[model samples]
Target chain A: MFVQATESSTGVSHDVARLGRLVRGLPETALVVDAITGLGTTDLQPDEWGLDIVIGGSQKALMVPPGLAFLGVSEKAWKLIERSKLPRFYFNLARERKAQSKSEVSFTPATTLVVALHTALEYIRSMGREKLIANAAMLAEATRAAASALGLGLFAESSPANALTAVSAPAGMDSGAIIKELRARFGAIVANGQGSMKGKIFRIAHLGYYDAPDMFALIASLEIVLTKLGHTCELGAGVARAQEVYLGFVEQEAQAAQAGRP
Target chain B: MFVQATESSTGVSHDVARLGRLVRGLPETALVVDAITGLGTTDLQPDEWGLDIVIGGSQKALMVPPGLAFLGVSEKAWKLIERSKLPRFYFNLARERKAQSKSEVSFTPATTLVVALHTALEYIRSMGREKLIANAAMLAEATRAAASALGLGLFAESSPANALTAVSAPAGMDSGAIIKELRARFGAIVANGQGSMKGKIFRIAHLGYYDAPDMFALIASLEIVLTKLGHTCELGAGVARAQEVYLGFVEQEAQAAQAGRP
Candidate 1:
């Protein structure tokens, strides 16, 4: 079974843990998760969930430029791949494993990008991966609060990803208008909905390389854009709510640390 | 048929042009040239030589860091590839072409390295690719002249590449000693013979990002290392010869430019 941990295009976060449980006890079955945008920002444990394969991309929560993909394949999947006689060339794991064993890459790699990723990964390690995930979660919580205060509906309200929040545009107003206004006024480039949701929703991304100040600016801009687009919006309403959420998170973190330290 | 325009591993250059002519009448045959290190440093015209495919690397004549491999596939080669039943995932040309037509990469790309390559290519284009190749040829000629003056025999005397010159070690002496001494004394990182010829020869690279001054320094350092290692070499003999070559090249370039002005 192949499933995306979160669908970025549709702003849908799938119940991956539930899916993992459903596929258990099927010895021949392998659960493959596309956690390209979910890893480092969400709760995903391939080992704990018995996932056979997990695919990741560098450009998302890794805070690196795109161009690299990472794969986690379980021992059982390796056995299955070996037995299957599908003619594989470039992505052949066995060939890559053989080269890696000798301390070499199977192909010419983007050397500078790898160096940059190494540096980014070192910083991530210094902060601890869990801490980074917790940061994303905090930011996501703040953004959700801000969106609700602004009277905007969540696109993925049932299951929102910590990496980003997708909010529907005000009734009768295209999201592209707000997206353009944010870019022009505040130099904030938000993503308009893709596919069928195009122009209907705008995404506020707070994944890697984002902080509380950025979220405040985004929410403040969103309020201004909504009012400018003729929607009845109270300026600072969203920003104040977002600030409250941020304040609450900081206090909670401090209390948790205080309790744990004692 | 597959052949290297210049074999960097063995310091040998093949007669690629002649081979291209040999396969002309055979419609089913496609000549593929591995010009990884040879492309910018050597004189090669794939189209003129009826080559169906040419492979290049970023770290070679482009002066960019390694991790990128480029391919020039002719329409004829594409037809053959389409007809062949090969299971290629990552290097799938058709898939890449489709994505590229929509102005996107087929996979997450090392964004920074591509940007670096773009800058290097812009510089290459501004100077003219032919000029860059000529510069490499001049440097290679000077290195060859310097090696001859130093009483060193050429490893690929019959077909030496313009990218680098490989010199045979003195009789009964390992090339590793000369290589180590060069690095230790002058900070020159010359390459030792690879594969079966290891320790038999030392190579002086004059490919991309190299100039006449670098050549002079390398030859002077070689003279010092050879003398220190008990070889009876005149200290300034190679340097003087290289200076003459550099002077000759400058005079020829000035004369040609002067003639073209009229």
Candidate 2:
């Protein structure tokens, strides 16, 4: 069964653990997860949660350039691969695995990209995976808080994604205008809604390769853009709110570390 | 209307100036130059040569990761774009130029890659463009000399590119085996020939972000891999030849500078 663990367009993450529980009832079914934008942002335990396959992209939380996609295929998925009759060529996972066994690629891989990914992975390891996750989550929370403080409504109500925050444009205002103003006036470019949601919502990304200062600068630029577009909002309102949220996160982490002290 | 100026597959570069002269003969024609692997490794005067369009890739001479491609479109090409009725959206050079004029992108740009490219560009500027090209040319000469010293033949008969050296593998020896041995024994990865040339030739790259020590190390590894693969070549034979070529280049440059003295 194919499932989108994280919907990139809407920035909504599905509960993989709960999905795993449901998939367990169907013994013949193999769960495939689209974790392209979810890998580094959320806590996804493919092994523990019994996920058959998890797909990832390099440009997301990996902090590397695009052109590389990663697949985590469990032993269960290997059995399916052995029996599956799908037409396969360049994306043949089995062939890739055979080459990987020899610490090589089946074809001419993107050499410089692989080198960049290696550096990015090393950086993630040095930062501690849990802390990196926490950092992303905190940044996402700050973005939400900042948007709320600016009197903007979030597009994702039920389950927001840590990778990005999708906020609705003010009533009757085109999100494209705000996006344009942000780039033209402030030299900041945020994503406008895709497809049907275009001109209705704007997104602020807080995924890998982003930090507190980036979020702060984004929020500040957003405030300036919004105000210039005739939206009545106090100056520095979003930035101040984001700063408060970030400081609160740091304080909570510090307190938790202090409590865990032996 | 479309022409490949630099053929990276065979490490051959066509004379763009000569091609431009022919292209100018046809009023409606526009010359497009593929400078992907050629940029930063050679002196390419697009403006002076009247090239209409030039395409470059970030992963090559820019020393950045992939996912970003650069296009240098002349005013002539812009006129062609206005008249040419091709259904264009993502790869639309007109839209890209508009965005670039404002120092922005039409879509979500590769943020980390752009930042890295900025640093790499700054480094290149500090090194001076002409000197960088000279360095690559010298390195290419050394690689060719080293390959020749090992009794390997050059693949490109005319206009060899400074970016990489394509040399034929020894008689009855597979280039793939040499590439494999290099990676397996010394953790050094080199490129084997592509397509019909597979198992026949090997490539040594001397593009951007590489220097003397890098070439020296690569030559040493090649010697080791060749010896291990039963090639009856003396150890350090290739390295000594490469060192001699490099020193000769330095001496020529020094003598040229002295001759130019006022």
Q: Give stretches of model 2 more than 4 Å off.
A: A1-262, B1-3, B184-188, B216-230, B233-240
Give the true-contact fraction for every prediction, in order.
0.89, 0.26
* Alpha carbon deviation, residue A219, candidate 2 (Å): 12
CAPRI band for model 1: medium
* lDDT of model 1, residue A20: 78
lDDT of 1 at A153: 90
TM-score of each: 0.86, 0.63
lDDT of 2: 0.84
DockQ of 1: 0.56
Interface RMSD (Å), every candidate: 2.2, 4.1
Worst 10 residues of 1 chain A by lDDT: A6-15
| lDDT, model 1 | 0.86
